[model samples]
Target: MMTFDPLGDGISRVEHLDHMGDDLRVVNAARISFDRESHLECDDTGQWLQDQDEKLIGFLAENEHVSPFFHPQICLRITMPSFLAHQWWRSTVGVSRSEVYRRYVVAEPQCYQPPHWRLRAQQPKAGSGTGELGAERQAALSVEVERLYRDIRTLYGQMIQEGVAPELAQAVLPQATYTRWIETGSLHYFVRACGLHTGPMAQRELRLYAEAVSEIVGGLFPVSWKALTRHTAA
Candidate 1:
C-alpha cells in the first residue's frame, strides 16, 4: 500500500498519488533568467550533474524567489476526518482537489474516538489541554461518545436499508466520518501548507496530517525541501 498510517486506527492516511518535475526542474525554471536551458545546454556529468544546481535552488529560496518552486508538482491521496478536511480546505490556496461524493458512492461511516477526552482550552479561543475531570469523568465521556456513535450508525444503516438515497442518508453522518480526496499542487504550495499546518497554532489532527505529507515531499526533493525549510525559518 502507498498509504502511511499517520494516525492510528486507520482514520487518517497520506498516500503519494503522482508527481511531476523535480529539484532539477525547479533549478532549470529559474535558470531561464540567464536565457539558458539546462537540459539542452548542460553536459551530462554522471556524478556531478547537480553540483551547482543545488546552490541555485538554495539561492532562489533564500531570496524568497518562490516561483521556481512551482515548477515541481505533486498530487496526494488523503483520507482524513471531515473536521480535519475542513481545516485542510481552508488552508489550501494553490491546490486543486477532487473529493469523493456521497451522491455517487456511499461514505464509509467511521467516527474518530479520541484517545482521551480533553478539557476545553483555557485561552477561550483555541487549543486543548489534558482533561482536569478525573478518570471517572473521562470514562463517562467515552461511554456517551460510543453510544452517540452507535445511534448515528444505526440510523444511517436503517435509512439505507429503507431505500433512502445515499446522498440523503449521508446527512446523518458525524463530522468524524473519514473523507478521501486527491489534492494536487505545486511543491511550493505544499511547502507553504506544511509551514502553516505544522505550526504550533494549527489543529492537532491537521498538524499530524501535514507532518505525514512533509515526509513524502522531503523524500522526493531533499535539497529543495531543505532550502524551503531554511527559507521558511527565516
Candidate 2:
C-alpha cells in the first residue's frame, strides 16, 4: 500500500488501497458506446495504449464526457482530522466510506497537532485562511492547544474505563481529533473531489489530501488523469 503523510504530520495520512479498472477500461467504456472496443497492445516492451485511443480519452475529457471515467474505481484509506473528514463526507455521489467506529474502539487515539495557526483571509473567497501567526503567538497557541487536547483525551479514556458509553464519550472529543476511514469511489469522483478540494476556497489541510490523491490517481490512470485534471485545473 502506498501512503502519504499530510504536511508530514504522521497523525494525518492517506493510503492508496487498491484500484479497479484502468485507462483502458475508461477508453473501452466510451468505445463500447459506438459498438467498438479498444485494447492495449502488448509487446516485448509490455503494454501500451494505441495512439488513437489515447487521443479519444483526451477528447472525452476536454468535452466533459465523464461517464466513461466513472467506469474505473479507486479505494483509499485516510486518517485525518475529524472536522476535515466531516467536510469530505459531504461528498456522497459515486462514493461510499466505512470509518472506524468509536463505539467499538475505546483506545485513546492521537489527535491532530496543527503546525501553526493561520490568519483568516477576508478576500478572494469566504472561509479561507491564509498566512500564519507570528512565531511567538504560534508557539503559545500550540502549547495551550496541546494541553487542552491532552486533558480531553485523558478524561475520555477515564470515562470509558469507568463504564461510560464509548459513543457518548466520543462526542466530547474535539474537532482536531484524528479518525480513519476507507473510501471507495469512481475515477471521476476522485478527479472532481480533488479539483474542488485543491481550490483556494478549501481549507489548507484539505489541499494536502487533494494533492496526495491527485498524485496516486495520476499514477494509476495517467492519460485520463492528465486529461481530466488539465481541464479541471483550467
Candidate 3:
C-alpha cells in the first residue's frame, strides 16, 4: 500500500502520490551554470547510469549549492490530526498544500488515539516528556476520549440538522480531529523538513511522519537526499 502508518495510528497515513525529476535533473540543473548538460554525451555505458557525476553532486552538496535539488518535486497525500497539521503548516517555503475542507464535505469524524499517552514535558508548558502514561491511566484516558468524540460527533450532526452552517459546525471540533491534505514540495524542502521534524523540538507524531517522508524521499533521490540530510536523522 502507498499508505504509511508512521505512528501506527490507524487514522493517520502518508501516501506518495507522485514525483518529478531525478538525480540527473539535479546534475543538469547544476551544469546549466556553465551552459552544459549531462545526457548521453559519452559512449561509455556507465555514463547512462544514475547520478551521472557523483563527484559533482558531492561537491555541490558539500559546498551547500543546493538550488539544483529544488528541481525535483514530490507529492504526498497525508492524513493526520489537525494539531499536527498546524505544525506542518509552518513550512511555507518551496511547498504547496491543498486540504480537505470540512464545510464542503461531511466526512466521518476520526481522532488520534495513541496506545500509550505521553506525559507533559518536565519544563512548564513545553513539549511532551520521554515517558508514557501508565497502562491503567492510558486505558482511562482512552475511555474519556472516546466519550468526548462521541459527544462531539453527536452535537455536530445535531447542529447540521438544525441548519447550522457547516463551517460553524466544524468549529466545534478540536485540534485532535483528523484532517487530510495534499502536499507537494521540492526535494530540498523534504530533506530539510525531515531534518527539522526528526529533531528534538518537533512532536513525536510529526517526527514519525517526517521519518516516513525521509524513507520515501531518500529512496527517490538517494545521493542528493544523503547530501542534504547527511544521514543525521531518519
In terms of TM-score, the best-performing candidate is: 2
Please identify model 3 stretches exceeding 4 Å from their true place.
Answer: 40-52, 124-126, 231-234
- lDDT of model 3, residue 15: 92
| TM-scores for all predictions | 0.89, 0.94, 0.90
> How would you encode candidate 3's per-residue C-alpha lDDT over 80-145 as one tens digit per residue?
899888887777879999999998878667877776788899975458988888888889989999
Candidate order by TM-score, decreasing, is 2, 3, 1
Q: Per-model C-alpha lDDT, please?
A: 0.82, 0.88, 0.83
Name the candidate, 1 or 2, with the larger lDDT value: 2
Q: Which ten residues in a row are the worst by lDDT in model 2?
A: 122-131
Clashing pairs in 2: none
Q: Per-residue CA lDDT of candidate 2, range 19-106, in tens?
A: 9999999999999988999889999989989999999999999999989999899999999889898888767888989999999998
RMSD list, candidates in order? 3.0, 1.7, 2.9
| lDDT of each residue in 84-195, candidate 1, tens digit only | 7887887565689999998778655888887676677877645775445678987999899889999999998888889999988998898888888999998888888888
Model 1 weakest 10-residue run by lDDT: 40-49
Q: Which scores greater on TM-score, model 2 or model 3?
A: 2
Best lDDT goes to which candidate? 2
CA RMSD (A), model 1: 3.0
lDDT for 67 in candidate 3 is 88
